[model samples]
Target: MMENHKIAEEVIDAVGGRENIQSVAHCATRLRIMVNDKEKINQEHVEQINKVKGAFFNSGQYQIIFGTGTVNRIYEEIANLGLATMTASDQKKEAVKSGSKIQRAVRTFGDVFVPIIPVLVATGLFMGLRGLVMQDQVLALFGMKTDDVSKNFILFTQVLTDTAFIFLPALVAWSTFRVFGGTPIIGLILGLMLVSPSLPNVWSVAGGDVKPLHFFGFIPVVGYQASVLPAFIAGIIGAKLERAIRKRIPESLDLILTPFLTLLSMIILSLLVIGPAFHTVEKGILTAATTVLSLPFGIAGIILGGLNQVIVVTGVHHIFNMLEIQLLAQYHSNPYNAIVTCAGAAQGGATLAVALKTKSKKLKALSFPSALSAFLGITEPALFGVNLRYGKPFIMALIGGACGGFVASLLKLKATGMALTVIPGTLLYLNGQVLLYILVNLIAIAVAFVLTWMFGYSDKIKEEVEK
Candidate 1:
């Protein structure tokens, strides 16, 4: 307790003292603090502080990296010291408002989806494992035909792998509601109603097992499963509408009437209008993605693979998960993940080369872990902390990723899931193309490493060390 307070005091001092802070928040890995003035911050002193992994200013906040658990303790101490604390969602809203329209839209996409990533990660792993177990070779080894696996086992794996996506609307709606200031539980309930058993399952409608219900013998509506855009739109409407309704309703009836009216209106509007309309938009996005990916000679892959990390630097890459998940849900495969994995490997590769060639101990210390983290599908540390700081390395990594993505697309490589990549990403390719996956990774790493070593680390390396 005392140590946390001491660290908090040091951090506060480093950032030009408590008086300079306007608001503060913490997420899984960083202390996100908004200050009244950036000039007052002693950047060098903050970097030198103990228990600080790294620090950088982005989205109008000076975010100090603290790995994981330590951040919460330090944040608690700072709050106890009387600084106003913001929720993670509120912090995202603050950050999103600082950007240009396109950047703000991207950040908004990230804010809506970031909270749900853990569930997606778990679903991805489960899908990978299920694929591994169901392979023909695995079945043969067990002295069974494709049909021989126990029905019970298959059903159990479905529960693990499909539950999240099957009810994905609920999850997305719940998170979106929280981020947008609606009652999250109400958001969840509204989302559930969209996929209620009373409505035909979306898959059943698509597969011809059941028909979409018609209203007044004309318009048709159905349940939403593995759908994102609709759930997202519904959440925003539901949240804003609830707030507006509450403002006019009297206090005596507020508690009961507010929720009742909010859900009732949202339910009818979503089923009769929002779901069908947004579902079409989602399908168009899915089709476009598929068409572009299937373009001759992997041109789209090369271009996207190269630019994806660049997009990450702008904090917009989180939007790609939507594409990956949509592909997986509709097509039972995700070539996008395969291409992006190569891109991720290239980031690590370039960072590793910089680490190897750098003369500065500070650069080396920061680059190594950042490189490894990139390989494991987390790149902020590498992108923000090391690669972007050196212009050439980032460009070199981009070129390398293009080459890797080209190879992946040409080979028609696919992953069983989304989210996991590189080392842990191996689970995604366990359907017997392990060698192909490894080859793609190596190609990316090798290209990025050679390019970076040859030209990425600049003459400024020694100058940084001297400072």
Candidate 2:
């Protein structure tokens, strides 16, 4: 108790004391502090404090990483000190206030997309499993050919893999509306209208199996199955329109009239204007992404793999969520996942190397679990808690990531999913690509471990550890 209290007090002093802190919050692994003046805080002093692994300013908050179990105790001590505190969600809102327009926009994208990732991750796993079971070699071992599989069984697998994507617009719209402060149920209904069974299916229309319905002899209408940008934009516009309508309507009629007017106007606008216009824009973006992913000699993989962790430090990596979704929607696979996993794997390897080499028992204890966490596809702990704390390890990890990415691209590796990476990410590669996946990740880990072991730790790190 005495140690935790002392640590909390020192943190407060290092970050320029109670008056500088506008608000404070803690997540699972970091104490997030929003301050009145950034220049007043001493970052080096904060990092030197006991139990403080590292500190960085990102997305309008000064964050101090202190590993998992330790953070909660320190947070309790801080709360007991009678300083102003808020929930992590509220702190994120506060942090938004301090960010630039572009930063805020990127953060908003993260906010909207993060909630929907689990469903996609689950669906991707199902797809990979189904792909494995349905392979010709696997089926032959079971004494059955592809034709021997039941149509009913095939339909069941499709249900597992296809439901989320079939209703992707609804999911995106629902999430967007919630983020933008509008009624989520109304947004959900609006999304359903875009992909309504009454309209021709998007794939069928595209494949020429069916003609699009011609409205007014020029505009053709089709369902928006697995679409993204149109629904996202529509949600933003719909939410604002709903708010506007609510204000103009009388209090007595608010319940009945607000939703009716909002939906009616949004339906027309989305179908005619938002859907057609934004979808073209979405296609252009996807084409550009594909072009980059196909760049000669694995250039795209090398650049993204090396700089992805750097982007994470800046706190705007969530924009990749949109691209990953777009790739799955169009191509039924995400190449980005395989490439980015190298970045996470490299960070884990570097942290593990530190844990093995460090003389400080406290540092080793914190680093081992953090490294394990990174291998399981969560990099924040190992990253901010260990590698970045020592500086040189992070650079070594980046070089390792670039090497792994080059191999992934050279082998034309891709994943069945997004969101999950590194170890749990193996689920996405189970369809005959497991060996290749393991090889790529092993290379990443080995390169990072060797480089970090050789040059990342030095007398400077030892001095910091002693302090």
Candidate 3:
């Protein structure tokens, strides 16, 4: 308790004392402070503080990383110091007012997607596990052929692997409406309308197994299974429409009228305008992504893998979420996942090297845990806390990412999932590609570790944050 209090007091002083703090909050791993004056905060002094792992100014907040459990304790001490504490959501509402337009826009996408990641991760694992057991090699051990599997068991497996994706639009719309301040239930109903069983299945229509239902002799309609962008746009529009309608209706008529009008209007707009228009746009984006990944000689891998972490530094990495959804929707496989996993693994590698070489016990303490987090598919601790703090290690990691990307591309590796990387991400490759997945990650770690150890880091620069 004393240590936490001391750490909180030091943090308050480092960020120009409590008077400079307009508001403060803590997320899972960082202390987020919105301050009266950014210029007054000593970033280096904050990073150098005993329990502090790293500090950076981002999205209008001076964020100091302190790992997970420690942050909640530190936050309590900060509150005890008479500086008011805000909930994470309340802090975000205030912070949004100060962020640039681009940052705010990207942050919105992150807000919409963050809640949906766990569902996707679980579904991916289900798909991988099913594939593993269904594989000929694995089944051979049980003296079973593919045909020997019971039809009922196969149907049950499909239910686990396919349910989330089939109703993905509902999830997207529900979250978007919640974010945009409308009734989430309305958004969910609207999403269901898009994939109503009465309409032709999208994949079936695409494969020419059936024709789409025609409206007004021109527009075609089909179920929007496995779609993302159209549902996302529809959700935003629906939320806004519901809010607008609520204001115009009488208080007595409000509940019934608002939802009825919103749904009626949104269904028309989604089917006649948003769905058809944005799905085309979404396809174009998917095509571009596919083209890049298909580039000869693994050129695409080299470029995206090397610069991805740099993108992380700019704090716009969430943009990839949409592209990833589109890939999984269209192809049921996400090469982007494999590519980004390499980038994440490389960062872990660089951080590990720093931990082993740094004589500073403080630096060593910070680096080891940060590296472990990176290996577990969260790279912010390793990136902001260690590798980026030392300039050469980040660069070395980028090189390692590029090498791993090349290997992944050469093998044409794709995961059965998205939103996971490094260690936990092995679930996505459990089919028949587990060995290849391990191989690429190992190569990434080895390259980054070797390069960082040999030339990128030394004890001399242990206390300094790279400029």
Candidate 4:
């Protein structure tokens, strides 16, 4: 506790003291501070603070990297020191009203989907496992026929995988509402309404098995399954509308009227306007992405592979969910997975290089787990915690990803599905392509390690950050 407080105090002082701070917040890896005067910040001093990995000014705020868990303790001490603690929702509300259009959109995408990543990760693992168990070759290798599989076991895996996509809108709406300052339960209920079983199943509509319901003889509405955009749009409107209604109603009547009125109004708007419009826009985006990703010579693969992690850093990588789903549905394979995996794997490579090159104990301690996490298919630990913080490692990783992606394109590599890469990616690719996947990942890691060691990573810089 004393150490945390001391670090917090130093960080506060280094960023121009508490008075220089307009507001303070922290995410999983960094202390995000909005200051009244950027000029008051002693940049070098802050970078020199013990346990401060790296610092940079971006998008009107200063972000000081402290890796995971540490930032929370430091942030708490800042709060104890009388600095106001802003909730994630409060930050979202502020960002929307004040930030640029693109910034607001990216923040919203992040806010809506980040709350649901855990379930998605679990589902990805389940998919990999299920695919492994269901393969005829694997079943035969186990001295069993595909027909001998246990129905109950298949059901269990299917349930885990199906639940997330089947009711995705609820998660999106609930998160969106929470971020947008509305009642989360209300938002979730509203999202549930968008995918209610009373409406025709989206697949049936798509396959021409059923027609979308015609509302008032004109508007066409269907169930939103495996969709993200509709609930996000509806959540914003519902949150804003609920807040507006709460302000005008009597305090005693607020509880009774607000939830009912908010759900009713949002449901009508979503079914008639937001759901249809956003769904159309989502389709257009998926179509365009498909065209680009299918280009000859793997140009799309190389570009996406090289720069995909850069997109992940912006918190808007959730936008690709629809594209991946479409690719798998249309082609039975997703090249996007192969490409993004390279980007994800390269971070581990770069971070490993940093760890190997760094002499500082603290730097080595932080770099190892960040690199390991990236190799296991999560890169934020390495990206924000190490590579992005150091600057050069991140760029080197991008180059490695591009090179790996170009190779994947040339090899015509694809994934059985989206999600899972690096270490975890091996399990899904074990269907006779394990050797190729291993080779590709090794190439990416080697490229990133070589480049970062040669030019990006420096032991001197690590010493300065820890000085």
- Top candidate when judged by lDDT against the true structure: 3
User: All candidates' TM-scores?
Assistant: 0.88, 0.93, 0.97, 0.81
lDDT of 1 by residue, 1-467 (tens): 89889889989998989889888999877899988888999877876666665688877789987756888999999999998899976776677767578877777777788778788777777877887789888888889877888899989998998888888899889988987889999999998998899998989998998999999787788999889888999999999999999999999999999999999999999988899899999999999999999988989779878998877766668788788878876776889888888888998999999889887677777788778878888776677666766677778889889999999999898887777889988988888777899998899989999999987876475356327
Q: Which stretches of candidate 3 lie above 4 Å from their native place?
A: 463-467
Candidate 4 Cα errors over 4 Å, as ranges: 1-6, 22-25, 59-61, 72-98, 215-218, 245-261, 309-335, 354-395, 409-421, 424-437, 453-467
Which pairs in model 1 have colliding backbones? none
lDDT of 3 at 333: 90
* Worst window of 10 by summed lDDT in candidate 4: 325-334
Looking at model 1, how many pairs of residues clash?
A: 0
TM match of model 2 to true structure: 0.93
Model 3, residue 57: C-alpha shift (Å): 0.9
Local lDDT at 341 for model 3: 89
- Model 2 worst lDDT window (10 residues): 458-467
Between candidates 1 and 2, name the one with more favorable TM-score: 2
Best by TM-score: 3
TM-score-based ranking: 3, 2, 1, 4
Q: Which stretches of candidate 2 lie over 4 Å from their true place?
A: 136-143, 360-362, 460-467
Q: Local error of candidate 3 at 463, Å?
A: 6.1
| lDDT tens digits by residue: candidate 4, 76-184 | 8999999977875565455455557777666666656666766765665566667777778889898998789889988887797688778888988999998888999
Residue 120 lDDT (model 4): 66
Candidate 1: stretches off by over 4 Å: 1-18, 23-25, 42-54, 66-97, 100-104, 458-467
